[model samples]
Target: MGEPLRGQAAVDQLLEVLDLKQIDAATFQGESPQVGAQRVFGGQVAGQALVAAGRTVDPARLVHSLHGYFVRAGDPTVPIDFHVESIRDGRSFSVRRCTAQQHGRAIFLMSASFQLTEEGLDHHGPAPEVPAPEDVPTMADWLERYPDRAAAFAASPQAVDVRYINSPGWVQPGDRDPAVHQRVWMRIDGRLPDDPLIHACALTYASDLSLLDSVLSIHGEVWGPGGVIGASLDHALWMHRPFRADEWFLYDQTSPSAGGGRGLAVGRMFTRDGRHIASAVQEGLLRRIGG
Candidate 1:
């Protein structure tokens, strides 16, 4: 949210960032966006760490889940070193732990599980009915209506095409009624390779973008200015079925609980045709500003 992240073309820059460099058999290096960001975006570190974990895994194995915690604020100017540890390899699943560090200090830690494809009993709830993505307004469209915030929006990175069912989290809470849930349709703005890992990693990067907004919905609060400032404590994601991150998917998100200076949000991703593909959970520390 500092400067436009150095590229009008975001996905390309993101692709380069996620493409970690191998330093050793178990270590990889990645760089944050070349901007004056106060801190590295958590998603970049997590996604890069996942890439490190995946590279050390069997090609036949695909990552199904990942849980990560923000250990420290990462330096945006420094390169991150990701160290992967093989926790176990069973007949069906391979587990890995990754630590992302900057200047010898661990900034993020993650554990991921990769599994061979297998048939399983499956059932899921129906996707909620909402206006199609085409019928919704994009950030660009909203910027036209809110001239005051247009400059800030223009200066921020736009890697994904997002259509919000509710107003964006940066909107003042008192400006509108509380949303039943914070819902948005999103996808990478550009085409990607057919690699499933890339798609997964892309989604992982995109996942952290707006998840905390669901938590803010509870108090009719947004982020910045009249709302609360928050930091992600941990994030967990589960890939349910195959899906492309470059295609439109509905992220139906809500906060089930909030207290003790923290709030939790859970979200489900549904494809255009309404198949549930993934679920994500995140908790963040929220502090009211100017209270």
Candidate 2:
């Protein structure tokens, strides 16, 4: 939730980022956001890689699941080349593997599965009961309260609107109880196209935002002075239902384990009406840098 790029312009920028340049039937290139970030965001790479994979498959096929690993820290100043492999193209399902390379080194690797629309068993985990998104204080509220962090927040690139039910770790270090569960509300800062792929890709980008933070929650650690250090190691996502990325959704997240310098987090996305839309799991590299 850095810098408020609210509205259609933010959404447009995100869409543009996800739109990869085709280099060949199995290769593409994507640009990193000039957000003054030191390293490319993992979510951006994941979403763009998915876009590259999706581009080579039938439009009728929709992405149902994706698993990716961060092989190296990506340099944000350079463009990433995505080389996709057609693993298989079955009658009803297509599988693809994508490797994101920078400086001739693989920075990320992903395998994704696409499927034709079909009926299936319809059931989902129950959504957690929480205050409506409107009732929660947003990042904007925190910015107002902490005048010192306003500059940093305003300068960061954020295409999504994020509202936390509790104080974000960076804002109020060690303020909350040590717990494994955390909840937040998020949606695109502006309107997006009607394409389901676009929506899925957008959510893919947004999904990485606060996931690892759930791991830090257990230690009452936030990402500020004397905060915890963490980075995503691997990520997996499963799409359950077609949904708009521009609409509000609840991210119910929990961290069940942390040891050996790593932490694992899992989350579920639920629409305002309680429809479960997706599931995400990630293991992050965690080091106690300070408090």
Please give, for residues 19-39, the per-residue lDDT of candidate 2 as tens digits: 999998999999987877788
For candidate 1, write residues 121-178 as lDDT tens digits.
Answer: 9999999999999999888777777767866655556788888988888887667668
Error of 1 at 173 (Å): 2.2
Reference-based TM-score, model 1: 0.95
Q: How close is candidate 2 to the true structure, as a TM-score?
A: 0.96
Off by more than 4 A, model 1: 1-8
- RMSD to the true structure for each prediction, in A, is 1.9, 1.8
For model 2, the superposed segments whose C-alpha errors exceed 4 Å read 1-4
Q: Using lDDT as the measure, which candidate wins?
A: 2
Clashes of 2: 1
